[model samples]
Target chain A: MVNNKGLLIVISGPSAVGKGTICKELVKRGIDNLELSVSATTRRPRQGEIDGINYYFKEKEVFEKMIEREDFLEFARVYDNYYGTPKKNVMDKISNGKDVILEIDIQGAKQVKRNYEDGIFIFIMPPSFKELKSRIVKRGTETQKDMDKRMTCAFEEVQQAKYYDYIVVNDDLNSAVEKIYCIIKAEKCRLSRYHIDLSGFKEEL
Target chain B: MVNNKGLLIVISGPSAVGKGTICKELVKRGIDNLELSVSATTRRPRQGEIDGINYYFKEKEVFEKMIEREDFLEFARVYDNYYGTPKKNVMDKISNGKDVILEIDIQGAKQVKRNYEDGIFIFIMPPSFKELKSRIVKRGTETQKDMDKRMTCAFEEVQQAKYYDYIVVNDDLNSAVEKIYCIIKAEKCRLSRYHIDLSGFKEEL
Candidate 1:
């Protein structure tokens, strides 16, 4: 009855498309028994972000050492900073029957796919490119050039949407979140993901 | 952004595991847009049966001729009666953007899988074999011997669980139906199932 192992869910989307917001919704609701996979980064800690909670902030030299050791499952340089997913923690969580979720950029998402093709990749898309621009503008942190760069990055990022397993359109927040949650719940019922020994069951006879 | 395509879903379960009950719940609730794929059979129509509604009943010779012509996707002979799925009708419905569901037996399910490998296969099971037998007895349509024969058949059917994409435990009717509905919704969001064209979109170059 209780034989499911776990699932590794990778979610990728353009910035300002609410990937973090939806992930926080999932975490807050505690639906489908999922745990967030915190990333390791070489970037300095922000004002309020906890070292372990937001990220395992590492020194540039240490991060470079890990990269040389091939310890990170996926690593990338973003906006002059380094970000990588540590292999050990993610694998450990999944192996222990806890569903692990990685909210990653398109590059890291692609790398994870190359390593673990079995992992579920979900792409979140904005309603339209126009709406996408407005969302970024509303954030009030970026210059016009910064906004342009992000939009450029988004166009290239969405090109990888075809590589994803699921594409959730983030038109409506609640509906989009529900779709992602349902996907997770439904995926848990997959027979291939379970630990059942059907061959040994008396039903075989 | 709007492309209409149909999906074929194959659902199977052991006798008295309440496949019909759960499917009816889904249909009644209009949870997911799905059309039931009624099969064609050569067996004599029992009392209160509606031709074309319950089944597309055909003469034995007609069924045999169709089988000879390879028109049936999968055909089987049981107790001197023939049963099969019409490939043309199912394909037509699917191509028109209708999701078709085939409630089938283990043998038929295997045959459909062999022919239509892209179809979604879902297997329903009771919480335990004890619960299964209890359900059969509660039905009151079978004698003790009949019940044993059905149980034996169920045991044999359970062996095919490994071949299915999903194994849903029918512990609670409402929950099982909800899970099935979620699976359908989630599958529609699959990148492989649907695609969007971004060519017309204005983006920062």
Candidate 2:
């Protein structure tokens, strides 16, 4: 019952594969018991990005200090910036019985896996690589070379799906969200997660 | 994908814990893709029992012959009657992409586990031992001695919940059914079970 702790859901997928969109839809459903884990990053906040909501924007020195303190669950340097998941916030929420969903890239997901083996790892996938290519192309902002690079990265990411506990294909928006919801509900029912009070049975005996 | 074979869901629990009721609800919900595996038994049919629907009623000779053929996924003899799950029907349905639900006792479930390790095993449980005892006594057919024997058996069966992948408590009938439904839906999205066609990616590469 209340003895069951909340789940740490680590979701990952290649860029343009709708991982962000699915997470948004899941939140929009108003599931009060769950929260999205805010990531800390040394990268500059983009236009319209909120300081805490979009990302916990941090100075390079502050981020490095955090790494020294082992404050991040998982952190990495990409190109010129550092990004990582803060350990305290996620751990506090889970201990307080709030499920936290962390949307990350494959590399960050691997880090999470090593640190938190009990977390549910889900990989969001495109319906087909053809569709994925078209979606990348449809974005207009990315040049052909950029698209190719993204696609190559995606190909490699998909190979890592075998390590995930669940693979959700984002063929349709609603269906994908529904599948994730079901996964959360079902995971809660796992025998290892649920605590059954057998005191009544002991009394009877 | 059609290549994804159906799941063999083995459900078991203590007696009078609402396993039958939950299965009936699951079927009534028009989960057409799933079918119940009809058990073969040598017990005499009750007043309203049908040949195939209720049980595959068979003569003792035929039941013994089935045993000799190694045709049952799991079988057991109780008192003067022989009961078992015929392997062919279940296997055929699974190969054809139809999920099969096998409602059996813990003993039979353990037998099935030895024969089929890939099955999703679920244990249905009562909210508490008090509730379970009340439910058994409410049936009005059991004498005090019968009730004591049943309660003892149920106590023993409850200990086997540790072996199950999922444990659903029948606190509310509808909620229990919904949990099982979600479990099935979520299981289909497992990376191991799902077949993703990456041919498009190969072509792109």
Candidate 3:
């Protein structure tokens, strides 16, 4: 029989490409033995934000120490906030046969790729340029300038999709979620993932 | 939007590993746009076996010449009977957007592997050595010698599983078939399979 380790599913995409929505739907649909990984952040928790649930809220000094010790799989400084995904918790869960999903940004995904070669890097994509622009427009930001800046950043991020292992377009929420779910199941069958012990097998007639 | 090409799925395993049964169940279960490829043979067909349906029956001279011209993807002569898989038909269907599944012997699979680098090579395995032996025994082979030979062949063939990209243990028929099906769906999402055109996308905010 084949004994497989749980996959570290790293999902990212252009800004507002619905990566979070797809992950939520996958969890809601109930994939067997699946878990969402919580990230550690140095930002102060807002109202209703639960530490260790929403994020492992850490002080700047402690977060820096954790980084020095290489406790995080990936961490980034974005607009004065330090965000990171804790490595130990994820690896521990995976060792215990739980597939962990990490919804992170492109920078975080790149770092995870370097730290964990076995992780499944998935890029969630919009159906078209028109659709991507429309989705951003629907957000109704304060100024056209802000929206334009976001759009340029998204274009740069879209190029990063080439680096990912798989790409699923977020045209239909359920379909995209289903594709990711199928990927997980198929990946479990991959030869690289399993320690198949044929030692128990005999050549007896 | 992403445009994916059809995949060439080559399924093989040790003798009596039930690769045929798995492929049959997959076709019966109706995966979208899936087709089974028919092989060609120099041996005469049995009663009720239709030419071009069961196989592309051919003359010895013709078969040999075809082999010379490299028309077959993989071929072998077993007990003076030549059996081969025609490459053109499979490629045509795949080019037309139909995923093609080929169930062949381990030797033939190896040849296909050399010929088709893009093919999805799947190795089907039994639950255990005991199960493999039991399955061979269930065939009610005429001689203990024959059964022993088959068991030995199966053992040799299983070693080839290491070269495959994926291994599906046929512990349960439905589960195994579903795993292969999921593999197809998941493979469609692979970055290598799609020529994703981001040109159709716009950066407008």
Tell me the TM-score of each prediction against the true structure.
Answer: 0.88, 0.94, 0.95
lDDT of 1 by residue, B1-205 (tens): 5347877888898978888888778778875458888779999889999987788899999988898887876888888888899888899988988888888878888888888888989999778878888888888878878877887788878877888998898999989988898888888898877657887455334
lDDT digits (tens) for residues B117-152 of candidate 3: 899999998787678777777876548777767777
**DockQ for each candidate?**
0.54, 0.68, 0.67
Find the candidate with the highest DockQ and give its number.
2
State in Å the error of residue A30, model 1. Answer: 1.7
Here the TM-score of candidate 3's chain B is 0.95
Between which residue pairs do clashes occur in model 1? none
lDDT of each: 0.84, 0.89, 0.87
- Residue B36: error of model 1 in Å? 1.7
What's model 1's overall lDDT? 0.84
What local lDDT does model 1 show for residue A103? 91
TM-score values for chain B across all models: 0.88, 0.92, 0.95
Candidate 1: TM-score, chain B only = 0.88
Local lDDT at B149 for model 3: 77
Q: lDDT by residue for model 2 over B87-173, one digit each (tens)?
A: 998999999989999988899999999989889999998888889989988877888888888888888899889899999889999
Candidate 3 runs further than 4 Å off: A203-205, B1-4, B202-205
